[model samples]
Target: MALMKKLTVLAGAASAVSYVRKNPEKVNEAVGKAARFVDEKTNGRYHSQIEGAVRKVSETTRPRTAE
Candidate 1:
């Protein structure tokens, strides 16, 4: 059970890395969606932080396509 848990964590981490690397546009879209969700939940109180976070996520998740 413990080993399975460790494997699950590893798999999730690896998928996260690959998702960010391969689908930067998806990452950007997801970030935007998340920001919007938060803004709606907070009634726009955290717009600055949400936008900043989305921008940071987009900046960090640049695509790495090989030709």
Candidate 2:
């Protein structure tokens, strides 16, 4: 049962990563909006941390270029 659950989670994660690679712009836009919303809710108290997270997520989802 535990193995099946882990496999399901991994499959979902793989699908998400594939989607992000194909639609990096959409992912980045959504992330940006979410970050903005969080910043507003926190009154900008965690602005730096939010920005850092946004950057990391963007980088991770960005498509790789062939050498």
Candidate 3:
């Protein structure tokens, strides 16, 4: 159970990163949705982990590219 939770956090973090890279403008909205889903699924036990992931993703989205 612990290992599974850890893996979920890692995977969620990775996905959040990728999502920001793929869609920077929607990063906050998307990460928020993902965080809610994860928190609900885990019964709120991993809210911090998911929020951390979302925050990292949100940060990534905040920076603009040279374009």
- Would you give me the overall lDDT of model 3? 0.83
Best by lDDT: 2
Q: Ten residues in a row with the worst lDDT in model 3?
A: 19-28
Residue 65 in candidate 1, Cα distance off native in Å: 12
lDDT of 2 by residue, 1-67 (tens): 9999999999999999889888899999999999999999999999999999999998898767999
Tens-digit lDDT string for candidate 1 (1-67): 9999999999999999887888888888888888898899999998888888888887788754799
Model 1 spans with C-alpha error above 4 angstroms: 63-67
Please identify which of the two predictions, 2 or 3, would achieve the higher TM-score against the true structure: 2
Taking the tens digit of each residue's C-alpha lDDT, what string does model 3 give over 1-67? 9999999999999997686678787767866887898899999999888888988877767877798
Ranking by lDDT: 2, 1, 3
Total clashing pairs for each candidate: 0, 0, 0
lDDT of 1: 0.87
In model 2, where is the ten-residue run with the lowest total lDDT? 56-65
Give the number of the best model, judged by TM-score: 2
What's the TM-score of each model vs. the native? 0.75, 0.87, 0.56
Model 2: runs farther than 4 Å from truth?
Answer: none
